[model samples]
Target: MISGPSENPELWAFLESLHRGEILCGTVTAIERFGVFVALDDGPDHPVFRGVGVITIPELSWQRIETAFDVVQVGQHVSAEFLQFDTWNLEARLSLRATQPDPFQAFADRTAAGQELHGRVTKLVPFGVFVQVTDGIEGLVHLRELTSTSVEKPSAVVQAGDEVTVVGTEIDRERRRLILSRRQGPTAH
Candidate 1:
């Protein structure tokens, strides 16, 4: 039912049949700083783009990533949901995280308050440092927890990429807040 030979028959037909929430698989053709590009197996080549499907940073994974390469690599095969059709670019907007299970449930099931865990410092804020205990779960290590000595800034005690051991002081599932402490001498750089 597509109009002309100049138009991609396979792509036109596939787009007509595509709908939100449909799951699709493709090879990661490219990985840019902003997003990941995928060439779908069941679709035709994009008329103007290198790949027909795109997964933005937030859609790449549930975990916080410093870059697109952190979650996927070129030639990696991924299955994702068809979030929408990008009419402007004539591409498919995809979400890779939608296909994966939530990692928080597993973290909560195994960990409890007072449990000491080792994680890498991901970010430093005015009040505290954010640490990634697992892939997607981050806990806040408040300024008071940075060290025994009174500190004016989190940078004085720790920096991003530093490894530190912390004790879970509080875990509020409803608030999704995890408070950690260094009361036991947060060592293990």
Candidate 2:
């Protein structure tokens, strides 16, 4: 069934407290062949919604196919587990990797201009060249910042594993972004 913004009084109030990361119990109001639809009971006993979460396919009992009606039945209040709650979306996104370490958390540190990191050029975009510092971390060196020459394509000179040193230009702790540059290398003119 199309989950086009469900409508229910108890579900709305249940989602409010959930946006604040409050655990509110949600009663399975309606279950379709796709998945179970839960309505958080306004009562204090069923407090489950408190963070942003959802009940993805694997998290559910059976394989959650996009178009399957054989997974769940209607009006089956099956004490479903809670993962997270978001007020904007009026829903929660469940995940099995919730307890796992945040992948973006490692990007919190982007300061120290002199802190050199050996990276490889991944792409040669018109704007600049994309460098991969680590497996998941990447920094960009603007085209104008690579060299004062008429560098048209970044790949013209730089390629994969060129052993480029990343010099931090700007640090965004919140955005988890680091503006990097290769123009001011240690041995540059």
Candidate 3:
């Protein structure tokens, strides 16, 4: 059997003390394409690394970021939520965005179905175009919703960075999903 962090008594003990959702403060030691490494305060020294904590790209921020550097830099001190213990890597899995407000939740709080909003097309998929209705919120405009006329592909109707008007067809706060339509639809009363 492959040995794991549990074999290290000190590290195992330290990991036991950590609870999910607990906030942890640490200095970012390194930033890579895969994730960010942090030297957590009050944690035992890692046996092989400068830090004992890792924050994956998706945990770095709620907003869509091109890279981990977009959210944090090396040597920056940050507070992140404890996600879990990585047994294989012997690191604490952290979430920086958990310490920050969810922009999508905030957007959903103020937005309602049938609300018309202006946005820029951010991406085009085979099925639909994604429109950035706000800084961190993007809604899908399905192919049929691209326009009143039938379209074969999203690119045929919209391109990235194209300014467009869309109506909110659904704002699923629970799922954190928002559906939009280019064709004018009923307004929220």
Candidate 4:
């Protein structure tokens, strides 16, 4: 039974009863390729323990994640489902299968001034890296744009969800309809 508001037994009871299930609609505290950290609702003002689940390279975005650098990042807010609950440790297993439009889809549908995305580094190659924007879209940050069009190596500027801005560049490839982009702007050198 729930003791009092101080105890927040409703949450305790839910965890105890859910057994090997989830408690959806939570906030993401941290993100990694494997999975994400979530804090559920109806709990104390403190952050609850949510374990990491891998999105794998391919699992990133609607297409395939070529680089870990292409997907989600830390400090960004995300909606996820509670896939599993660990009673012993009070940790929750989360899933990106929580919101509609999924973030990735929304990004793809964007044609506005600019966008702010928080992604994780799926991979870091010479050219640049891939960033999974949401759950179904990945954007490329080429070498030049790594820092103000003067960059030769993408790695020198950003690692992953360094949370960079992707401005719409003129269509470079008609075949693929490629969008040329550079990091936000103003390189140190």
Candidate 5:
């Protein structure tokens, strides 16, 4: 069902508040490949859509994930940033990532360079491997860091889902980049 402002007075007011960037808590009503539909608490219902809020894929989480379920599930309650009215669909476009605490910030606050931690390789890139060190936190292991021996590709030493120990070499808080090294006594699966 398409969404838009309803004739209900209270619903119109809710949409107005949402347009002002008001953060709201809502129960996820449905999960689709494209987005999550939310039944907002204290929010006006769409005349036909039944729910009033929608969070698109990119807005689901900070972490790169395979699907929306990786971050949230049906019936889960979530707090989201109300971006703006999706006039094309007449629904309030929301961002779930904006409301969650950043895991990278927490990981950096207590961690220092040269510390070791275990992580699972998440993605293999031409130049590096992306590893998930913790929930919502990932670091890049450059091709040079994957092995001491000269290698042309990162896949030579690492593949997705391999568990490896990594040493933190750099953490750029401003850019939110975490650099890791696997050369220091780290064994890969």
Candidate 6:
């Protein structure tokens, strides 16, 4: 179990003062492949790190990025949402994406099952191909839905960067999932 500020009064007091989901403004102090460090405005100084806050790769942005440098740079000002207090690291976990609109939610709002969508195949796995339906939104085209006939692998049907037309078979908003099909005809209602 994670302990609160009472465990270490001085180092954790700044994080204790913050609440989850609270918006915070900070400057990007360091950008690593794994995450970014932020020195929060009006926050206490840290003895070990340049900042008292950290934002992991997944929390940096909603879009799939190759590196932390792609989304942020050192000394850049950023507004992030407080996620949690990291007792081990003695820093507050933050999320830069939380401050931005969720692309998946926006896509789900305007899209419906059976809708036709044009996208580029982003990745191929043993089970399916991931298609980028829109910026920051990728949907899975399961192997079974790749075609009417049986296939051994997704690579046989499509390659990365291949532009394809797919029909949305299911839109699971709660799961943030979109199931797509490329079965050569209108999707059955």
User: Of the candidates shown, which would achieve the greatest TM-score relative to the real structure?
Assistant: 3
Model 3 reaches what TM-score against the true structure?
Answer: 0.92
Per-residue error (Å), model 6, residue 151: 1.2
What tens-digit string does per-residue lDDT give for candidate 2 at 1-189? 212235445555654444432344444454444344555354322234332234444545322246323444434433344566544555754432233343445554443655666788877788888787776667788877777576887777677667787776765666656677776757442
Model 1 accuracy (lDDT, Cα): 0.84
Cα lDDT computed for each candidate against the true fold: 0.84, 0.54, 0.88, 0.49, 0.82, 0.87
C-alpha TM-score for every candidate: 0.69, 0.54, 0.92, 0.35, 0.73, 0.90
lDDT of 6 by residue, 1-189 (tens): 234567657767777788999998989998887898999897876667888889999999888888999999999999999999887778889999999988889999999888999999999999999999998889999999897888999888889999999998889988888899998446521
Point out where model 3 deviates above 4 Å. 1-7, 186-189
Clashes of 3: 0
Q: lDDT: which candidate is best?
A: 3
How far does residue 91 in candidate 2 sit from its true spot (Å)? 2.4
Write one digit per residue (lDDT tens) for candidate 1, span 66-97: 89988899999999999987655667899999
Where is model 4 more than 4 Å wrong at Cα? 1-62, 65-106, 113-116, 170-189
- Stretches of candidate 6 above 4 Å error? 1-8, 184-189
Specify the poorest-scoring 10-residue window by lDDT in model 6. Answer: 1-10
Q: By descending lDDT, how would the candidates be arranged?
A: 3, 6, 1, 5, 2, 4
Residue 171 accuracy (lDDT) in model 3: 94
> Please, what are the lDDT tens digits per residue for candidate 3 over residues 1-189?
223545677876787789999999999998888889999888987887778899999999988889998988889999999999887777899999999999999998899898899899999999999999999899999888888888898887778999988999999988889999878665311
On a 0 to 100 scale, what is the lDDT of residue 99 in model 3? 92
- What does the lDDT read for residue 12 in candidate 5? 59
**RMSD after Cα superposition, model 1:** 5.1
Total clashing pairs in model 4: 25
Question: For each predicted model, how many residue pairs clash, with residues at least 3 apart or on different chains?
Answer: 0, 24, 0, 25, 0, 0
Candidate 4's TM-score reads: 0.35
